[model samples]
Target: MCRWLAYSGTPLLLDTILYRPKHSLIDQSLHARMGVETTNGDGFGIGWYAPESGSDTPAILRDIGPAWNNRNLREIAQHVKSHLLFAHIRASTGTAVQQTNCHPFRHGRWMWMHNGSVKGFHEMRRELSLAVDPGLFLDIEGTTDSEVMFFLAMTLGLEEDPPQAVAKMVGLLERTGREHGIAAPVQMTVAVTDGTTVWAFRYASEGGARSLYYSTKVDSLRAQHPDATYLQELSEDTRLIVSEPLGDLPGAWNEVPEHSYGIVHGGHDSLHEFAPIMP
Candidate 1:
């Protein structure tokens, strides 16, 4: 498993969220408190949208090296700022540790990252890979199940209905996994963005999904932690969805319910039950 975070709200330097917090993503790269592994150092990646650039495509930086000690990442995080960003620390389940295999995979204006595995992927890779739309399949640059899922969702209609698209993607995996004699084949906590809104999902084929959390609303945090001046600096709509809380602030995080998904669109965020549908 791995650790990842998605942030959307007031524009701020990546350092603030990736390195400055009490238990920042960088810290989790070395010492994750909730992930299956205590350290996720195979590789890392960051993707952010620069709306000011007038391009819908996001900027992505990835390296096949531990994030905690990557000077390039440190330098970039210090200088880049964005209203929507995604950062992921990788601990490869089985795939080779390479830049292309890193998380926060990008396609057009969208970016995606996942923290869990598609069980028995090796046995079913060919079947699943062939399922991706022919046009989009040629664009797949990596060999991770995470990337495969992204393309599968895209083939299913991610641009028009992200939730439904993902549901169908997972459904395809489950149906195929069963045919391959593999039980409980899907396990994932995914975060995807289209440079404007973020959609996060937490689900597993067997019911026990990995840990996922979302920050409490800014206004609610203000009311609870009156002394935390930082709360005042952010927009009321600011939100964070992560594999774990960035800190131990009381009432600062809420676990995303099992087998469900959440959407963070400006200030109209909503959570809904998720159930896979056969593609």
Candidate 2:
């Protein structure tokens, strides 16, 4: 399993969310409180959409090393600014420890990351890979089930309806796994974005999913704790959705209900029940 965080708000230095928080993602990389494992140091990655002039697409920086010891990450985090970002720390389930296996996988304007695994991934890998469109298949650069799941969503129309397409892809994987006698085909807590909007899902073929959480009402928190230093420093529209709360700010986090998805854009947020797509 792994730990990840997604940010959608007024552009700010990456350090504000990745390092400044009391329980920042970098801290979670070594001291995760809710993940299956406390340490997720296999590798880490960060994806962010720079202003149009910065680059043609989201800039991705990935490495096969511990987040806590990455000097380059610290340097970039202090300078880069983006309205949408995805950062992940990995604890490999079955994949080799390589840079490509790090999360926050990118595709055009979209960036994705995942925690948890595709149960019996070795058994389902072939079928899953074969299902990807040839065009998309050629783009896959890694062997992690997380990356495979990303391509599967794109093959099934992630750009159009990310949540639905991901659900369909997961459903297909589960069905294919069942055909091969795998009762629990998928286990995932995934987050994705197309630069502007974000979609996060928590689900598993076995009915028990990994930990996923989102922040609470920014307005509510600001009103309740006007003196909270960070709350006063942040933009009124700032919002964070993560695998765990960044801090213990009372009334500052909400648990995403099991088997559900969350969407965030322009400071607004919504959640939907996750349903498997029938073959």
lDDT of 2 by residue, 103-212 (tens): 88988878889898887889889988999989989889999999999999999989988877988988898898888998887888999988888899999887778888
How high is the lDDT of residue 151 in model 1?
Answer: 99
Across 1-279, the per-residue lDDT of candidate 1 in tens digits comes to 999999999999999989999999999999999999999999999999998899999999999999999999999989989999999999999999999999899999999999899988999999999999999998999999999999999999999999999999999999999999988999999999898889999999996899999999999999999999989999998999999999999999999999999999977799999999997
TM-score of each: 0.99, 0.97
Clash pairs (backbone) in predicted model 2:
none
Query: Clash number for every model?
Result: 0, 0
Q: Which residue pairs collide in model 1, if any?
A: none
Best by lDDT: 1
Give the worst 10-residue stretch by lDDT in candidate 2.
229-238
lDDT of 1 at 59: 95
